[model samples]
Target: METQRNTQSETKKSPQTQPHQENLKGTFAAVIIVGLIILLSWFGIFGLFLERA
Candidate 1:
């Protein structure tokens, strides 16, 4: 009975000891897209100002 309990506790702890892997490709792509949009908007406004000046 004690050995069974130890085995059960070890099994539970095993998963927590391992690192969790995540896929960040979508997250990276989203950040890049947002950055590009902000950059483009800034450049477009700057260009318009230059043209008017």
Candidate 2:
């Protein structure tokens, strides 16, 4: 019974790493969004592929 309790406690402690994974996923999404905004702004300013008169 004591060993069972110890195993359960150890298993519970290992789950703390899950939040770090979630944080990385969120940060990655933020980076992609910012990058797309910058790219679209560049295209808008330069007017790439516009019809040349």
The whole-model lDDT of each prediction reads: 0.94, 0.80
lDDT (tens digit, per residue) of candidate 2 on 1-53: 99999998888784444443344788889999999999999888678546342
Most accurate candidate by lDDT: 1
The candidate scoring highest on TM-score is: 1
* Candidate 2 stretches greater than 4 Å from native: 1-22, 48-53
- What is the C-alpha lDDT profile of model 1 across 1-53, one tens digit per residue? 99999998888784446678999999999999999999999999999999999
Model 1 has an lDDT value of 0.94
**Ten consecutive residues with minimal summed lDDT in candidate 1?**
11-20
TM per candidate: 0.64, 0.47
